[model samples]
Target: MTPPLAVDIDGTLTRQDKSIDPRVFDVLRAWADEAPVIIATGKAFPYPVGLCEFLGIPLRAIAENGGVVYVEEAGEVVYNGDPDAAWAVAEAFEQEGYDLGWGPADMVNRWRETEVAVSLDRPGDRLRELAAREGQEVVDTGYAYHVKSPSVNKGTGLVSAADGLGLDPEEFVAVGDSENDAEVFTVAGESFAVANADEHARAAADHVLDASFADGFLAVAESFGIATQ
Candidate 1:
């Protein structure tokens, strides 16, 4: 079987500002021709899917941390999964007054809608302050903020996507740099942490890469013996 290459977007493949080098996509385009190189991110439906298209690579994607899974069969996304478990876990955090945030899957078409919010669970102190100021009801999940949707998170989302793809967790390899990426690390056969990863995420990852985004991505990809253009 062709091993699956699951890569993170925000702080892994792209820069911290989320910009992609043209060559990155070019490399991805080449890799896609060889195997299933998927984008696994905490982002939601449209953007993640769009990124794959922009890269000119139509491999499978585990988006919103796994809340949504997409596989391009013909020309567009053809598979999806819900974050039921994520909802439950998020709810637990909300009940604890932890100020939870839902990912992009919860807001699909309404990404621009003000009523929807995404929350960040890390940088614990910052999150706590935001929770207090935003009334525990207003915090950005790197997308938007809404109180009720706190039950959403990335790790569980990735699991749902893994299941939907019918790929064994052991066949997948995830790379990330934050708290949200914890689950992907757990499920993947191998996991990597970039040098700039937050403490929690770095601790959770199976291996720590020597470089940061756009800086070390090629080296890390090569470590997996992946062919890069």
Candidate 2:
């Protein structure tokens, strides 16, 4: 069997408008027929789940950067860190005059069970310092910052998801477009980065595609000879 393909959702699968291009969904549906397409994303748990449901695909998801994992039939499992601690850190940051903006009212927030995701204008280094002092981690998703336990990350979540599916971590392929995806590149047997990916992501990936977003993902599938139709 072909190894599962682990993909980041935000910038890797969505277009500039932050919407899933229909073509991308088409490719994903095709890829799903060949192998599991596990979504490893920094978004909240429900976001990816909703997307999969809308696409009518039963893919697994790693949400909150790696704090939570959800299998199609197995429900959600907390993979790392304490949600209380993460929320406390977010509160502390808020009290310190750092504007920690929760996502839209409909989406997940610090009150969620796995991670505290907040939008901030503060410097990334400062956030890192605060997180480190609290034994937590700060992940910059380019669109938002996430606070979670230091032990959890995209790589860890992917491993757990793969194992749950009876797949080996070494048999998975990871693809993403940001620094948070660095650990995933290290853990997967092979990794790819879109052309628009950050320097850190590009350096970590085994191959960098000339395309961006869903097109980049399709390029990867074609290279691996994974049928898209």
Candidate 3:
């Protein structure tokens, strides 16, 4: 059977410059034809939902790095972890005289409902401390550091999505390129990391691809005999 595919966005589906690779549209759409193509990422809610809409795939996503799971087919929008963790972190940053590193009118976390994403350019150690104080953990997703509850992650989101789809989370194949995707690697039946994957993601992946970014994802699809072309 064609197993479900759970994929990350920023470093998995995007190019090196962080732009969403249009080349992946057909490949992911093909995977969706066989089974669900789950867009799992640290990105905000609308990002993946918009991708699904354009890719013509099921509007299923594990957003906020696992803090939120949206299964459109099941009409289920599940919110996990500490709902106020993001806000708490924001408040803490204010107390610490930090600007969240985002300029005024930050749009990054504007639509975020659960977790907080800190710019990688900021002070990671300090943000981690604040997150820990808020009963949250900081996950490095290559592009940014996510401040979120430790309990909810891509792994748990996959389980919830599977339950809604009547599939098994362990039967799914996960692919990503950063630390936030580690738990998903553990939960999936098989895990893959792109050539550009970070140490945490590479260590967690069952297969490390030769290609990077969208090319790596195409390699994964081809490995499963799901031809993208």
Winning candidate number (lDDT):
3
Clash totals for all models, in order? 13, 0, 0
TM-score rank, highest first? 3, 2, 1
TM-score of each: 0.66, 0.90, 0.96
Give one digit per residue, the lDDT tens place, for model 1 in 1-229.
Answer: 3456677777777776778755567666665676667787656566777888777777567655444566654233433332333244345445666544444454442432112233444334543444444333233334333232233345554555556566666677677776666657777788888887777678889998888875656666676565556
Please list the C-alpha lDDT of all candidates, in the order they appear. Answer: 0.58, 0.80, 0.87
TM-score, candidate 2, is 0.90
How many pairs of residues collide in model 3? Answer: 0
Q: Which stretches of candidate 1 lie over 4 Å from their true place?
A: 73-109, 112-153, 227-229
Residues 1-229, candidate 3: write the lDDT tens digits.
7788999998888898999888788888888998888999888899999999988888999999888898877897999888586679868877887777677887888898888777888888988888888888888887777888899899999999888888899889999999889899999999999999999899999999999998898888898888777
The residue-by-residue lDDT of candidate 2 on 1-229, one tens digit each, is 5567899987898797888767777777777878888888888777778888887889588888788887765555756768877777777777887766543472547335677777756666777777777888887777777888878889998888887888887788999999889889999999999988888899999999999987898788787677655
Ten-residue stretch with the least lDDT total in model 1:
109-118
- State the TM-score for model 3: 0.96
